[model samples]
Target: MSTSSFALRLMDVHVSLAGHEVLHGIDLSLTAGRWSSIVGPNGAGKSTLLKAMAGLLPVTGSIFLFDQTLMAMDRKQRAQQLSWLGQNESASDDLRVWDVVMLGRMPHQDWLAAPSAKDHAVVETALQATGAWDWRERSLGQLSGGECQRVLLARAMAVQAQVMLMDEPLANLDPPHQVDWLEQVRCLTSQNTTVVSVLHEVGMALHADDLVVMQAGRVVHQGPCADAVTHRAVEAVFGKRIAIHALDGQWVAVPKF
Candidate 1:
């Protein structure tokens, strides 16, 4: 298939942090309108991979967004195509939830452009989608970690980007919120948005449309999420402490003992 057909494509991608290599020579092509999960142990470069894909980390590889080379696109153009939720994102504590959500509209606006009716509608819809509508008037400092995370997710959704890249998005979420998070991802895919996320929850990651198993700075496997071969790859990448099982028509990884 042509590279342009892939929603997000990478060629020989490499990333380093604090003078140490985190990702090495990774090549991946995420299909359009699919939900993909990046799973790995601590320091395995799952987050690094996502950051590289979002153009957050300076890396030494070719990244293409549909038919355009990522680096060639201007900042505004790239921001319009890719929306990102970074790990442990923190905003101004003084801003209200609604104000924070409005930040997502910046990419679509000119300098000093005021929020339009369309922007307000999009923000409202995103807040409802993330269950943060009720907290729209609340100050960011007053919210619990989970609530703030939801608000941030709503902001990302408000960007209305074709590709969403999230790093450890479920970090502050509860069990119910985690389930809702997965459903939000599915909903994005259904709307033809592509998503890639770094997740610590193996079981949740297994539910994605495709899986990328990373280990020691390399992509050990990438394929259909339900394939037995991919299951084996997950087991191998994570070691025997994790076991893969089918539950409710979805694959999950759990402890063996």
Candidate 2:
């Protein structure tokens, strides 16, 4: 694929935590305007890879956001180009929902500057999109686990970045809210945004446009989600304990007997 077609690229990427190398050499290219899910069994380093792509952790290889070297970009520039939603993120309990979402605008604002009108508009739209508008005045600590996740998602959406990296975004979300989250992701891709998520729910991960299957800290398969090969790879990584099936025109993973 042409470099221009990629939203993010990595070459020979390696990560280490606490004197232990977590990710091996990884080469990945994520197409722009597409949603890709990374899945693996426990200790497969899915989150570590995502963190590397986000530039949150030190990496030994090259990572580029579009054409720019990720580590070379200034903090503000990186923040404006890539938005991140972490798993089980903690926010101050006293922070109002609206204020928390507004924080997403920090990259676009001047130091100590008040929010511009456009920032307010974006935050409001994000909150409404996540169904958290009614809680705009409520504090973050007052919300349930699922509710907090929605708010954090809104905050990430409020950034309106070109690429979004989400780790376990569906955590704490019930089935209905999970469906809502899928819709929200679809809306993002419709606008040509690139979304990469690490999900533990195999069924939910299959909903993505493509799947990045990993095992033992290396990418074992990268292909369209509907492909039989991808399904086999997914099932393989999980020790064939799950089976992939097509149900009502959508793919789902079911437990193996």
Report the C-alpha displacement of residue 94, candidate 2, in angstroms: 0.5
Number of the predicted model whose lDDT against the real structure is largest: 2
Least well predicted 10-residue stretch by lDDT in candidate 1: 248-257
Report the lDDT tens digits of candidate 1 across residue range 1-257.
87666999889998888999888899999998999999888888888788888888899989999978898899999999999999999899999999999999899988998999999999999999999999999999999999999999999999999999999899889999999998999999999999999988888888899999999999999988889998999888777788899888777788976
* 47: Cα error in model 1, Å: 0.9
Candidate 2 residue-wise lDDT, 1-257, digit = tens:
78989999999999999999989999999999999999999999999999999999999999999999999999999999999999879799999999999999999999999999999999999999999999999999999999999999999999999999999999999999999999999999999999999999999999999999999989999999999999999999999999999999999999998
* Whole-model alpha-carbon lDDT for candidate 1: 0.91
For model 1, the stretches where C-alpha displacement exceeds 4 angstroms are: none
> How well does candidate 2 match the true structure, expressed as C-alpha RMSD?
0.6
Model 1, position 108, has a per-residue lDDT of 97
The global C-alpha lDDT for each of the candidates, from Candidate 1 onward, is 0.91, 0.96
